[model samples]
Target chain A: MNIEIRKASEKEVPFLVRTIIDAEKSGTSILPYEKIFGLSEDETENILNSILKQNEEDCELSMDAFLVAFHDNKPIGAVSAWIEALNDVSSSVIKGNLLRQHLSMKNLINASKYWQNLQEVHFDIPVKSIQIGLVYVAEEARGNRLAEKLIKQQLEVLQKKINQKEEKVFVQVYHNNLSAIKAYNRIGFEIIETKENLDKNLLGVLPDTKKVLMQLINIKNE
Target chain B: MNKTEVISQLTPIFQIVFNNPEIQISENLTANDVKGWNSLTHMILMSNIEESFKIKFSLREINKMQNVGDLISLIESKK
Candidate 1:
């Protein structure tokens, strides 16, 4: 089957949002109100509105890219990436210089706390790695190699567009998602960090849930 | 090896892994039949099998394995 990966257009934000909600329903199963990012209709609308607003201004909080996978003109899956500024307030201040030079000073001051609180990973390396946020294959479309196809196609596109040697790919998966973890490992992603403690913190906020984050690093092996 | 030989070989592994006496295994036996076959237990089983068989399983094969028969097939292929 021919699978096509295309940039999610502004017109398709609703569809993308819907797909994410449906996928989260079967995928995460997080209880309502306990969800960090609400998945309900109105909440999804708010999220989409924020994304659209950022897109219109070309000033996103994070370097974001969303793509949708389709087969025979029917959407099957979607994936998104965001380049996070792990740390370095000075660098972020410099980077924000593009928005407004006058606000650069204020931006630096305001962003200091946010940037300071930013979760630190391995950032000494030259590679500007991205955190894969959303990777969802429709429940019906799963297990037919569609997930593999979607991921491999995206990897190929990213490799061609980005410097593979300098860019590392990363994703967080729940430790219980054995199949997903297995598939990711088959695609050459290795577990770099296990956020077992984060699971406990999340459980406190969530009341009852056991979600462990498994970080996969796509760096070249030594 | 035939199915019985495969089962006979796997019986000891299952017995030790699950700590169950008189553990019965068949071509269709799966983790669902045994208690404590979660992710951690699965890792232990995989490590033990790898050491015993002197063969490592890729994450793909490990995840796709549904029963003892699937594992036997993977082991046979390795040999």
Candidate 2:
């Protein structure tokens, strides 16, 4: 089987958005927008597509930020990585879009409560580092170390583009997602810290499920 | 080698890597089926399998394996 990993093109935005939604549902099972706003799959896709479209104009969530894995010419998995500071800006845009989508009063309250709870336990991401997020491997394509491959490839690309000072890279995984955490660990990432007491009321997850922050420093060697 | 022989060789490796002697593995068993058989241990398991079977797998071959049965088939083909 021929495997190709490359930056996603604008034509693949719809596919990337769908992959992200599917990955969020299957991998994490923590649907922040879905649970709060009762969004259907199509609704979520529309929102994400709009975000990607906007990204083309301002790069808030550009396709270049994503790397798609194709096996035998079929897309099987994807990962998105960028500088941490970009996320802070893109998140505000996402939240604005959510509000403009006219979320109900009850859902608005729920979103507020969720953000409050998240803010309490959130860790400040380290500066001068590339942050990896939205990691997903197709359900059937799992168990083959595709996630590790995607991560390593992204790291290699980022290392050449950035300076020597910005050598650290990090990824955040849900504490309960042991497989993902373990995958990152095998890729030389260490658990820097964990943010506890994530608001599970809206997410409908177990109380023990916490968000973990893991980092891989010194990617030059690996 | 037959399926039973391959499994018999793999069972001890799984036990040693996962630190669980009672781990029962079947052809259809996956990472989700076995406790502590996560991504990190999965790599270690792959390395151990390669050493035991004296076969090396490419990244494509490795990603294609979905379960013990798939792995056993790959091993058989390599041999």
Candidate 3:
């Protein structure tokens, strides 16, 4: 497929931001930040860029956690993975702190209105698991298995940073994202957990009420 | 505001943010020690604290915060 995947650099901030926005959308048009936090798409992009450019490996949101795939010198796909609980701080705490720093008081206040509802569908990736997220491939670059290549290459990089012998690798996805589910299944990930919330209030705040956690153990064991 | 005053004020914020009226704010309290203290509500909690204290936390300050003691200390210093 002529796809070359490498650790993303600061120069790829724009691409990484797009990949994150797309991945967070989960193949849907609903961008949670905009709907839940009252952030404009541009505002969300700027915040994402701020978080990404900082190069903090605190969570999946950090740019240092992502691997970019390039075909013909243009980025086509990207994926982020991180070992949770570095130095005793959970990725959620680090990520929350990061967002608290960048998000405006106004946005945060607006988020407070919807934040409680987010809890209804909130899914936490355990502290020790290797969480793989923000998996995205450019539309033009699809159908070539670029996502699969990016994820495998990303695992190779993450396996070194993670110290433990056997760490459960996880990816959370909307159950309706059949394409993503199919892709993860191809890579030996199985659905280990599923949470469904049928509340009608989540119509705009979340893309889907049903979410699933996919797990992979020992890439080589496949 | 003194630590006592901060703790007194902070107690309600924590309880309301976590939606647990039974919570008693203590120095040793960490995110793991509190139920419903996950990433989804953390920012809302921070912003609420800012409004209550009328202070903004820098990225470094937010990142360095470890527990309730650190939070009260930071808020006290900021106030």
Q: Using lDDT, give the best candidate's number.
A: 3
Candidate 2 to native Cα RMSD, angstroms: 23.0
Candidate 3 Cα outliers beyond 4 Å, as residue runs: A217-222, B1-5, B26-28
* lDDT by residue (tens digit), candidate 2, A1-222: 467998887677877886667555546455655764566667777777866655531122456778899887678888877753332222222224323333344544444444434444445444346768678777778888888889888777766666454567777776777877787878878888887773455347322347778888544334
Stretches of model 1 off by over 4 angstroms after superposition: A22-26, A31-34, A37-41, A49-53, A56-64, A82-127, A198-201, A204-222, B1-79
lDDT of 2 by residue, B1-79 (tens): 8878888888898887667789877877755456444333444566667778988776446545556788788888887
Fnat value of model 1: 0.00
lDDT of 2 at A1: 42
DockQ of each: 0.01, 0.01, 0.54
Error of 2 at B51 (Å): 66
Q: What is the TM-score of chain B alone in each candidate?
A: 0.86, 0.91, 0.96
TM-score of each: 0.49, 0.62, 0.90
**Most accurate candidate by DockQ:** 3
| Candidate order, TM-score descending | 3, 2, 1
Q: What TM-score would candidate 1 get against the native?
A: 0.49
Per-residue alpha-carbon lDDT of candidate 1 for residues B1-79, written as tens digits (9 for 90 to 100): 6656666777788777656677888777655455544322344456566777788666445545556778888888886
For model 3 the local lDDT of residue A92 reads: 75
Tell me how many clashing residue pairs each candidate has.
0, 0, 0
